[model samples]
Target: MDIVWFPLHITLFICSVTAAASEAALAKPNCSSHCGVLTEIPYPFGIGAGCYLDHWFQIICDRTASPPKAFLNVIGLEVLEISVEGTLKVTSPITFSNCSNKPLGLQAPNLEGSPFVFSQKNRFSSISCGGIALMTSLYGSTIGGCLSICDNTNTRVLQPNSCSGMKCCQTTIPLHLSAFNTSFGAVLNADSQMACKFAFLVDHDWFTSNSTNISAISEMDSVPIVLEWSLLDYTNFEIYGTNNWTDDKITNCSSHCFCSKGFQGNPYLLDGCQVPSSVLGQLFLLFGGWWSHKVVRKRKHIKRKKKFLKQNGGLLLEQQLSSGAVNVDKIRLFNSKELEKATDGFNADRILGKGGQGTVYKGMLTDGRIVAVKKSKIVDRGEVGQFINEIVILSQISQGNVVKLLGCCLETEVPLLVYEFILNGTLSEYIHHQNEELPLTWEMRLRIAIQVAGALSYLHSAASSPIFHRDIKSSNILLDEKYTAKVADFGTSRSMSIDRTHVTTKVQRTFGYLDPD
Candidate 1:
């Protein structure tokens, strides 16, 4: 007993305790590991509110550009493509030699002012016809280039979008291109029989025969160009640590998607889209594949949604004749088209109110019943689909406080629940906006609260199956001109078996009045 345990064992036990404590104190990563699938609202590319840092990270959508360019704010750098691992394939514009009346030879364009620097790993990719393409840089630094090609008069040729020596001579400039003027010159060789000359930087893969074959002077002019850009002399680790973060990390992009800089891929073996370097690809991009992946996913998503609808009691609903004491036939089945007519395609003016569950619209039925319709935009959400529960709950109790369920329409893309229209505003409007607490009096607030509590107490205790009004916020409690309270918006309520007082479900009740448990 006096000797105690071994010294090494005691030391190990203490170390284990310290490690556990450290882990308990560790802070969670501030950012979300991945944005929702199909939703590309990445951290830097967020919606209205406080989603982004500032203007520097603006994702300017240029519909004017071919294929519509997406620029990253005031930096002036054009984003060619973004990857999941937080890397972007960008084009570094190089100043090619400017063609002029002067007799001077070729020189590198003025690339010194360019924010982007050329790297040995990148290429210049140029298309030419009849004339020489050259780039002249500052400080007397120069790089020269010459090109030649055949006429497109050959009958065996496919004159579509091609530029192979027959009419267009395609080539690449040396690495690390920056700042130079653009210019075109004649080679003055046997190929010099051509009248006009044309040249421009183009994506090696994007260059085509059309640039050369379709020209009036029979020379290539403006070719689609792509400049590969990366940080200079960065090790694998340093390249990944690019501090100039513009937008947030993109977890998901178009299919076969990878992350640009500032992100890494999923740590696991290629599960979701990520921005990892080693576990993910370094330089493997197929533009065609990336483009087509979206179409494939869109089709798949539509299928999944249909499947979810059928799974969530959609088929059971079609079975008809729910004999749970409630008059189930009172509820009508509405198609997406039917609801569009009823609410005028969910017109803004018809909107009564909006909540976490969905949008509420005012619609006039064919029989002239002006009803309030709650539409479930989130088809997968279980909250708005509890039509059966409401029908069951309403059938048992005949009460003045609870709003009557006029019925529901479920055959639509979104389930539309119809309730008796309460002409007066909500209790919140009286309490907050109109300062009803002052005008309506303290006795009115107490009476309204008591009225709401009584309605909920009845639902929770008296119904055949004990019902819990999961959402009980003041807004859900409506008030008539007579000051009588009528409980409304029981979107997330539960009707449990009398034997079992509570039921388990995916929690989607609104905040401020959510279940304590």
Candidate 2:
């Protein structure tokens, strides 16, 4: 009875071993895990039918080569390595030419339907004496290019692993690029066979790690190119569950799905999502602390801006602009950066003049427009309303005799006023400086009187809001390059409503030239 039982047990053991081997051959579900030497094909990528997630991840194992080779389906790009971060390493073909006038160009693979895309890790290179290489995106937009100009004397000392148009030239590609087209233009004076032009996209590591001569690029057929593989299509995980997925999940899925905060894993797979409990606590602490710090900084920035706005009379200006008192477009509110850049970081050399109201700096705008930036020495809390009144009055003045108020910068502790720069010295300098080489002529003096009178007349009567230049003086009158007088400095001016006869205000005027009326 014991011998009979032993024979039955042996048969059962053989059956179990065969079952385990069969199960190992079938990777997940019905997918083949290994294709010859390549055994690391994880989920989403499979060898045969029913094995892979879809046709996009299907791989073909070619056993006909000396050593078995595996290629991505349809595209025939040789597979080198697949990473957990969705990066695929594959062999890219090279295009080469030896003729001097005839330069060869290499085009990237047409990755139309596949889950794979060209990664930014790769750089497009052109090996030649001198030529213009153009890289274009799939949508027919020229992304970037590199030009190489070479000669016999400049041949031997090409920078090792550097592509800066010496012997070899290279440029970076955009991320998540599915397809690109590379073409080469003839190098101006490439006259040697060694100056053979070749172009290809290669992995950065291969270019740096290997001792590759630029002239010997034709000797190489295929270079390692990196690709990024994903789900290719995105399906709403909220609407489609793994157990009840529609055909769209298998076909038209999107590549936008990502692991939520505090969760990590292959977002392309179901149940592939995992939580590393050991590091999770630390990760949460780090991320949460960073988020909270950002929020605090943002709150501080808001509070500071609010304080400055109130101090700079931003509220009063807003109220005036909102009530249709001024044309909003005529008044430009400049930021601190523009003013800082225009004035060469507020260098002392740019100072045009200084006054009690503010200091004026000569600044060149980005558009080549010159302006005089008036920055107040101090922010008087009580005078905030008065500052806004000046801005409002200047925005309404359109007379050619008056200095045009171009814009203002309120982001600083004190508001800055921008005016069209007057090139010549002020009326006071031309009048008082007796030894000055360029004296104001009798006709010029008469023209200056007429221009100042016209500006004053417009301010007093023609303006939408009547203004009185209470502080008019020769010092306040600016002269342009042509010696045309431009009445300026409205800081101490007063405005009155249309129906009002006069504004009741303190008599603020420059001594010796006070308003006699």
Question: Which of the numbered candidates is closest to the native, going by highest TM-score?
Answer: 2
* Candidate 2 TM-score, true structure as reference: 0.43
Error of 1 at 467 (Å): 0.4
lDDT per residue (tens digit) for residues 1-517 in model 2: 5445654755664564443333332234445555666665665667887566666667888889857788888788888776645688889988666644443554568897777788888988887777777778767788887887775586365555666667678888877678778766756774643455677898987787657655455577778899987653644443234446433222223553444555544444554434434444544554576568778987987787678877898888889889988788998888788999999988999999999887899999999999999988766788766668788888888899999899887768888899999998589998888646677889889999999988888888899877887888999999998888999889878887788875566678566564543
| Per-prediction CA RMSD (Å) | 21.0, 27.7
Best by lDDT: 2
Tens-digit lDDT track of model 1 for 1-30: 312534454466556444332221111123
Provide the overall lDDT of each model, using Cα atoms, as 2-decimal numbers: 0.53, 0.74
Residue runs of model 2 more than 4 Å from their true location after superposition: 1-299, 502-504
Off by over 4 Å in 1: 1-312, 318-325, 334-338, 381-388, 395-397, 435-438, 501-517
Compared with the true structure, model 1 gives a TM-score of: 0.37
**TM-score for each of the candidates:** 0.37, 0.43
